[model samples]
Target: MSTRLGWTAALMLSALSLVPARAQDAPKTWDVPMGGNSYLTATSADAAKRGGRNDRWNSPDNVTSVYFRVDRAAELNIALRAKVPQGESRIRATLAGKAVEKDLKGAETADVPLGKVVMKAPGYVKVDLQGLKKTGEVFADIEALEVTPTGKDAAAVVLNYVKDNKDNNFYWGRRGPSIHLGYELPKGEPTEWFYNEVTVPVGSDPVGSYFMSNGFGEGYFGMQVNGENERRVLFSVWSPFKTDRPGEIPEDQKITLLKKGEGVHGGEFGGEGSGGQSYWLYPWKAGNTYRFLNRVHPDGKGSTVYTAWFFVPEKNNWQLIASFKRPKTDKHLTGAHSFLENFADRQGYLSRGALYGNQWSCDVKGEWHESTVARFTTDPIGRSLFRMDYAGGAKGQQFFMRNGGFFAENVKPDQKFTRESTPAKKPVIDFKKLEGADLGS
Candidate 1:
């Protein structure tokens, strides 16, 4: 066996009657924990946590859903691991409108079988569980959704899910994979400016989706669907201080706010990595191409200033988003990339995509370098094989990436893709005009 094989692979091999299979393949029954892979999509964010480890769905209104994948057709016998204290409760489980109702009256956890169904194809499956009626303190303390193949052809079935809670993957796995496109840049060329355009197809724009256009070594610039009523153009830069807590940054290492455009809010953001964050609530629409431009230049005094601008086609003008100077750093933009990610885990079940095109980087010598090639990659979630729902490649002259929907047949990671360059479609930007627009006092 290859030492590079994951623990899930080893487990699958051991359970497959000594027959080998691919990574994250479940030859036996797949026990997908409800706390890890389930979400209450119809409830508020506060009510959704009721489906967590300690507590579970009690309200009949909370529409809880769990998801997984099967590599082949299977006669799947579905069951739920749960317990109801006091009186009895009812749960209606539905898959493709084939509904099964189960009564939960036991105070102790047990595998309550919800009958069987024949999946005629290979793909992701979503099981919806809803509370019908209950006479107890809560509907039930549900834990996991177990699926066992019982048909004669079950021996060839392969299942995929969040196999275990290792590496705190339960939280990370729920949100799915974050996919990227690394733009290939010329060697030895210092990039002072990076310009890229992104267009979200009409139906591809989903809530919680971040369509990142320009990503450098230090930070990323993107637009995100915050909610049904809110969207934003966001930009952030990590502090060289290297701390997860923004307050811990030293005075000299703190990100200095140089300037910001009107309607843009600038503040310190923490959690992933402490950094200065800025955003503007701009209602950018789908199907309309938006332009992103970023400039990275050293201040000659051991600091680098980053300025971002957004161009809206409706206005036919560019708006300076924000600018910040990071201390203890002196370098031009390096490692240019773009990514598509789902920021809200509750909305992870929804599909989203973004089209990135017209990548051009201006060197310090003021030469415009056309970037027609990019390397496809993903975050650790995809690399770990924990989630394989991300895809990226060249579509026409633009590069596109889709993630978070659990669609099958993902693009292989770490593959290089080259888009046909449209040299005539290169951006004709007025740098001087951008410099003159709303300079902060």
Candidate 2:
């Protein structure tokens, strides 16, 4: 072939190579909101709240972290959506063992590039933003983290997080995921009483955590970390009227207070549901096993009565929490389960866990049966694919559950577990003594 023909053939080969590069799909840029996707990881974490609720991270005291998930390993180009009210501010973004510093000074918020990060594997990734220096009142009102993936593997990346504000998801997403264990009661017998024990490990008990030990069809009996200085054993029974507002519940279908022990506070509660709530402020310590006993039975007057008593191991005595009679209900305990939940949205960044073991249920004939099998499950938050930090299963002879803290390990729902039964440890109770309480008129 001539020199002209050879040059034309070389050009055709080079053009073919360029076509593939130009046709490659552009990687998408994900704008992850900070309202429901960030945590204040500082010396005094709540110090970041000067601006607003969990939505704004404006503190210069410590690192403000944002978390999200990816399906595959990615080389992420990350930026911060922030603005300085006045003057310039210096900030640092750290991710995957790399840190990038940038200075910003803008009247309005804008996407400020912090540089690139490479996630080695698929899972949750944490990006820590710290204020190096600032000339304004605060470092910057960091609204969201803008992630733009590039490179050959970038097109395979999919980020998962609380994407929007619809349906109050920012509130629920920040609260993390709630997990539960469904107990398998004996099929042939009636559950007149449910007995279970809960032990929260030291350092695993955080504020706003509820370790529900016993749950029935109408109510639940559990203990919670209400505040830094307060802990309570709580029992509540729902009104059959089915309303979110307690004032709207018809008097006939309302839950009536039957009796309460000394120092126990009993009243009506609403928001989650209308119910009669009872609680006793007790100095419950962690790493100690606490026992819960719940009694449910029909009063023959077409109403069901629920009574709860919690054993204080420190005092070695079972104190009555309260008792309530539910109108228009004449059934025994049916749905037997225990759940772990975080009620405070701000506390969702911390990890908490509890152990449920030695479960037993008594029938009308006064025979106790052991519960060795259970199924692990999660709430809608877990299934929504937004928050997946939850786990539960049998570890030796007890079932343990862990949630929050943005952990990567997640236990799938409907997973069954069987713990070794401790039949020799059956509870011995004096039925006559418990029944002799003077439930006054």
Candidate 3:
């Protein structure tokens, strides 16, 4: 294998780098050490009655405490999760001296905004003693608590380290209500890699404009367009091609818009947000255009994570896009059409689709992963097309890319014309001699 091929295999297994937790900002967390066989199995009950049965509910610790010493007033976002029985359990967040209740169901993933309990002052925020009860004994697992800064100046930081080059500073900016971010592929790129995770501060609303793209064959891409604005977010892989074969494209293919999830392609629009992963492909286009959009934000810091892999074609190169938006007290994205209600299949593109449960449409694979225009390459180029791998088992996790490269190709079709089979005689000479002279007389 070539050096580029060797590096592509290396980036597949490792985790990515993560922003270090600040010494001062790390919140004090204590795990509840409750241990024993489950006292109760599954049962159905309401919120207050479920707290009545001892067998149905239990806490890691009888009590868990978290203290803070903020020098000044600061806005912070906090996240908490627990494994409780089917019925509702009474949970509380006591800040300074007041308490607020929260409800946890197994189906709802732990998102910063989901079961959020906010505090405005500095002091200890404690989860009070439980009033949980149920028929049988079950484990109420207490997850971790995370607190981070939130403000106009508070930005999500991303550092891309491709091959051996680091210092690729990727900056995302919030302009009024829109976001802008991009990066340059390193000279020595890698294939078969994953995007570990991107962290964002809490208190941010679900993002509306989600878009991302890289110049290569499509990889597995995902888009989570939840929340009330009902805006569409797009995340896709892209390339330029001329034939039906996969490796037909060369290393110089330009990045363009690949797969896209317009309007509310999956779930409903509400104040709530969700996250998940899926696959993607870039439709073949004649012109080479680098740069695409992932129109939505990763569902906050802990909600979105992905893993993808690309075959190292003959070339290797790529970049990433991530974003977020805060909740709006007013009307959302103005002048934008409702993409969900009036979606039409784009002409001249190969399309497939799927719908799961009630709200999600899994069209990225079963249907929408291919392009109508057939293009491929057959070159021994050193680099490979992009690859992506994703797993969301653990929230707030990171990834490390070992080795990779971007694949690009140039393939455009040439126009061809056919001549008529039979030749025409000189009929024009007879027409000129026949009628025009008589009309003048």
Candidate 4:
């Protein structure tokens, strides 16, 4: 057999082996563990009678629907554990375009089967709840959703289904949201530092932005390769505030630029978590590997400091990106993630792929650990509107994320790196030669 065919077969076998044999009999349960993707607006958690919290308190005006993914076509027993409010309440539940209605009464909670839903394919199962009669504050309190598979070879079916739908388009449907792959630190084990090596891949779309972030939401530190008309390497830090401009950001939540390289711009950009952003107009070529490092530790003064660094292979040295101070919080690093997405128009069908690996994180005690696992997830826009194509998997030791275009296949994360590999080579740019060069628009 050809070498490529041999590798393909091996990968298929490995993927299938990851599925537990008991999954055939085990029913898929949706709860809090499913993360933010499971619930929508107005859907809050309520105490369940049996134990654990039930996703409930959905009203007619708001909480209209819920979404979940199914691996294959199967006979799924769709049932809802809920309590109907006082007076007769009509709930019209639809799954995969199939609709069913139940006329419920009283305040007692019970498991109401919404009948069998035939999942025709491997995709999201959107359950829309509509109250036919407008009465009372809420229609019902949804306790849980039980999806028990009644088909044969459930485990095998799910694995095969994923393999078939793994590739997603860049612009529409499956790949629009930044596909994230990273580890969320366990509670109490906050990360003091984190770093990763990534090779920026060429993208079909030149308008999107690729982000490698070490921390989530209000506070984060990382690098971005903006693929606008002029390609640039952007290193930034976000404070825990929602300010319009960087200067307007409070001192306590500001990220100060201590130093920068030639041609690098330092300032604040508007948007979420406004803080400090440093950009260098370097036309980073595709397929070249780059290393990003971030250290989060407490500054002498009561605040925390986030420092970013980039290692250019050609320069064989690490360059300082920026340092930002986050006041009032001395917490450790929380979320570590990377994503490839487009920020251009919806019709923009551009696609991109990137390899990320050698991810290391240090705890407050100064111990370091290599992260090897991550939970894959999509954004709301990608999950709902754009069925964009996207997929992530290990390419050897490295893990890669690819999205956009229907034919895009998974790339092997075989790129390797080490601490001793630095200071070995100079960067592609000749600082002396570019000294008098004007890279203009």
Tell me, by lDDT, which candidate is best: 2
By lDDT, the better pick of 2 and 3 is 2
lDDT at position 296, candidate 1: 90
lDDT string, candidate 3, 317-391, tens digits: 222222222221111111110011101111001111111000111121211111111111111111111011100
C-alpha lDDT values of all predictions? 0.80, 0.80, 0.24, 0.53
What tens-digit string does per-residue lDDT give for candidate 1 at 1-441?
A: 111101122222222232235355443677776544666557546554543221345666667777888878878888876667679998898975689888889876667888777778777778888889988767776667778887677777887777665666666777778999999887766888899999999988887899999999999999999888899999999999888899999998998888888899999999889989999999999998899999998888889889999986777888888888888898999989999998776667778998999999998887898999999999987887767788999988999999877787778899999999989987787677885233221
lDDT of 4 by residue, 227-343 (tens): 444666676666566776666777666666555666678887775447777776666666777766666666656666666666677787666655555666565566776666655
Residue 282, candidate 4: how far off, in angstroms?
2.2
Between candidates 2 and 4, which one is better according to TM-score?
2
How high is the lDDT of residue 65 in model 1? Answer: 76
What is the lDDT for 12 in model 4? 22
Q: After TM-score superposition, what is the CA distance of residue 441 in candidate 2 from its true location, in Å?
A: 14
- Between prediction 1 and prediction 2, the one with superior lDDT is 2
Candidate 1, 348: how far from true, in Å? Answer: 1.1
Give the per-residue lDDT digits (tens) of candidate 2, residues 202-295: 9988888999999998989999999888999999999998788999998799899988878999999998889899999998888989999988
Whole-model lDDT, model 4: 0.53
Off by over 4 Å in 3: 1-61, 68-71, 85-87, 107-109, 112-129, 133-139, 153-441
By TM-score, highest first, what's the ranking?
2, 1, 4, 3
Tell me the TM-score of each prediction against the true structure.
0.88, 0.89, 0.21, 0.50
